[model samples]
Target: MDNNKLIEYLETFGALTSKDKLCLIDNVEFKAYKAGDVFLHTGKIANQVGFIIEGVFRYFFYDGQGNEITSYFMSENQFVTNITSFNEYTFSSGTIAAETDCLVLIIDRKGWELFAEQIENWNSIISKITSKTLLEKTNFQRRLINQDAKASYLSLLEQNPSIINRVPQTHIASFLGITKFSLSRIRNQIANK
Candidate 1:
């Protein structure tokens, strides 16, 4: 991962001093994952948080029936982790899996704490990130409760067209809380219209 790109990405959140930027850079460790790899698993302690340097990952939950429900996708320049697990040092209830080959910048909880202690501006940045994640999750849950599968699929398509091509249709369907057959029919209907 290019350090310049990572610095540029961080700059978007807020302006940082040279010292602050260097401190941020010191905490990050780059990692790569192959397609079909599980970046995180449910019921495991999540020790690290990741910033996507490239590619995509799906965050999901599996039901007792072995059905998957995708919560969201994290792509280039996005941060992701099981928040509860990351913050509380508890087991995760959701899994994050690589949807494609990926490059990520990982910071362990200790690294994050060290950075937070040293960077005065980091608290505000962290708050903004958490707020946005919460808002997105809430909005998604609202949409799922109020809209049909077709509507949900359309929403996902509108927001992340790249995911339609990068992720499997079955996974997309699961994300939208619909059966594969239903999603196929919906896609066909939309295509014909």
Candidate 2:
């Protein structure tokens, strides 16, 4: 498997020695998922985490009303996992599914544990990654809560310019907490402006 992208992303958190990087590479198995394939189903335990080398995944769950709600999108270079489920061996509250054909590097819980045990600074690296991921998700939620549909869509475009083209309109609408028709109208209004 090509590991250059993974290595580059890891470098952003901290300096990794050649041996450290090699160890990480050794523990991972590359996998492919078709669009719409679910990685972690809601209420299932997440036994693995994936690093996206290509494409997008959506984190979503069904509401009490049975409507699917998109909580977040994970794209290239991002790690995809239900953190709680993966860490605590509990059930995931949301499902993670591919939004497009995807390539990922997977490390199962066993491999992850082994990696952590072998790497001295692995915990510190994970801490930084976790902090950044939490901050981004929190910021996304904060922005959505304060914005109207149009404003939320605009903000999404500003943050993820290619998402509109890369992901399905229905998923995008769900993510913005708007009906698909409303999102269409918003897009039309923006185009006319």
lDDT of 2 by residue, 115-185 (tens): 78987778888889999999988998899999899999999999888678899999999999899999999
Encode model 1's per-residue lDDT on 21-89: one tens digit a residue: 788788888899998899889899888988888889998898889877887888887786888898888
- Each prediction's TM-score versus the true structure: 0.92, 0.96
lDDT of each: 0.84, 0.91
- Among all windows of ten consecutive residues in candidate 1, which has the lowest summed lDDT? 1-10
TM accuracy, model 1: 0.92
- The total number of steric clashes, by the backbone 3 Å criterion, in model 2 comes to 0
Off by over 4 Å in 2: none
Highest lDDT scorer: 2
